[model samples]
Target: MDTQQDWDIYDVTIVGGGPAGMYAAFYSGMRAMRTKIIEAKRELGGFMRTYPEKIVWDVGGVGPVRCERLIEILEKQARTFDPAIVFGQAVAGMNRREDGVFELTSTTGERHYTRTVILCAGRGMTQVQKLDIHGANRYELANLHYTITDLSRFAGKRVLISGGGDSAVDWANELEKLAKEVIVVHRRSEFTAHERPVAQMRTFAKVLTPYRISGLYGSADRIARVALTHTETGEPEEVEADEVIVSHGYDRDFGNLVNWGLEREDYGVSVDAKMRTNLPGIFGAGDFITYGSKVRLIAGAFNDAVLAVNSAKMFLEPSATDMAGVSSHNERFFEKNKAVIEEEKQRQQN
Candidate 1:
């Protein structure tokens, strides 16, 4: 870990590397503030990274964008200002300094200081729920996948999806088109996902309800089959599978934020319309923020990020504009990005 004294305090420190945090980093650069983004994961994009193949349609202007593609675009946009980014570091605690700067310590023992902080740490650290059956861990990397980073891995394979949630049903529907066979096993008859996709999945994929995964079996290196037991009758059944997708859902926690002394609800941190939390110089946004009429959508999170960044700017410099003008007409932006813009235009012209 680098010594804290060796580093310069940033004008803004954005937590979490999801879309909201990434956008905040970009806007902070537009505001000409020195910024840094800290993400716990090895990569950016937050939960979207787990669903790389899923298509995102709600974000305006970008129609039907693949999850991986959107994340790449957002990462590029965030890097426009070249903010310092640290990955695989989870913030463990924070403190306010006498000079009004914030000091953050990570679980890795590294420290960072900043003028202000944005808690875009969406749902904090999240881990996918895994199968409890014996020998499950042995096949985790071989054949059992909690998330789909590459959809082609299941191509022409027999896939078994264990869960009744939206992700499970969605993956089943998606894999049905590529996989040789797709089966969905759930512990309950009723699914927890939206009805439309579930109904669509029934049309193609085999649905086995009121059943729980009992065992996993195969060679020492790979999983070839899974045993399922009926939830009501205790009857057992076996299915041959080339891959297993466990989408039971994620176990999420706010990590150190729970002890940060902020006012929070059962869902997430509470904030005002300005995205200001109860603490001064600290704000919250993304799925981890809660406010009246707040919608849990990527679009909503983007709006939240903008509001939080603008408020943070004002908090840093009272005379600064509350809102930035349109990027298209901003001469300073064009000047800063003149070469890149010109190159893009040249490419289009060709």
Candidate 2:
């Protein structure tokens, strides 16, 4: 299945198709730069697609839009610039060559040689961390879902969400009106979510005491009950529910770019305000960069994309003479690849 290819040169190559990467592509297009977006998954909108039904509480300037709604808007804006996007291709390795260009190798064995590399790949390919309870695996592909991709299906059903972070609270608020009953389970005494959302959830849904999910009980095929154990007293209880939604955050492992030897500040790639990494042509935006005042919101990522694109543009054209030609070439590339650039999707049904 590997359609391996040699290095495809690009002005900027953005890894990960999340909000950050999407905006990066858009900004690159606005700057008239030849850019390519590579996403591991078949679809765009990385984490946004993971919880399309949940309400976005953090995106400032936009009032509590549904995750899927934001994805649609961002995807549309990203495509307006007309950039080549490759799906189902995960970045396997990246390195700065002696010639000052980045050599990026994808998991599918495709090569991309780019003048600048922007790592907007937030959370580096996130997946739900599941609780390995008995009977959980059987329902995973059916009634049970680890991440809240669509909340409409649970409109009238009783749903129990596990986790205390912002994600758990976001779902609780988003599905309170949709679901018949929403119960939040947190292992700690205090909520990890923002104060406003926590207060809102208390008024709408039932916030459970400090407890952890013990196991899941089911009937012939679907989940029927969830067992919980109190953190302090160790008291056990069982609750009947129609669905179990686990929002216990995600595990981020950047083994793909670990060998690049880039400077690390607080376990992330060190970057300036323009999202430029320690390496001359390498930059990291979104949640992948290390900085004192870093914002991980979708809007913040978009702003970062602007800065990174501008820096990349200047880097590409150190002299003012090449600027006009670069812009013209990028415009031509975008117009020619309009059909091939947009609407690239891959699906995995296993």
Error of 2 at 294 (Å): 2.9
lDDT of 2 by residue, 1-350 (tens): 22324446788999888988998898787777889998888989987777776678788677889889989888987897678999998897876666676778898887777888888777787777888676578888767777766667898999898889888888888887889999888999899899999999999787778999998777766888988999999999898889888878788767567667778766467788767887788777787776777877777787777777778888887752322335445654566465544544222321
lDDT of 2 at 184: 88
TM-score of model 2 relative to the true fold? 0.81
Q: How many backbone collisions does model 1 have? A: 0
All candidates' lDDT scores? 0.89, 0.80
Global fold similarity of model 1 (TM-score): 0.94
Against the true structure, candidate 2 has what lDDT?
0.80
Per-model RMSD to reference: 2.2, 6.8
Q: Could you tell me the C-alpha RMSD of candidate 1 in Å? A: 2.2
Model 1 ranges with Cα > 4 A deviation = 1-7
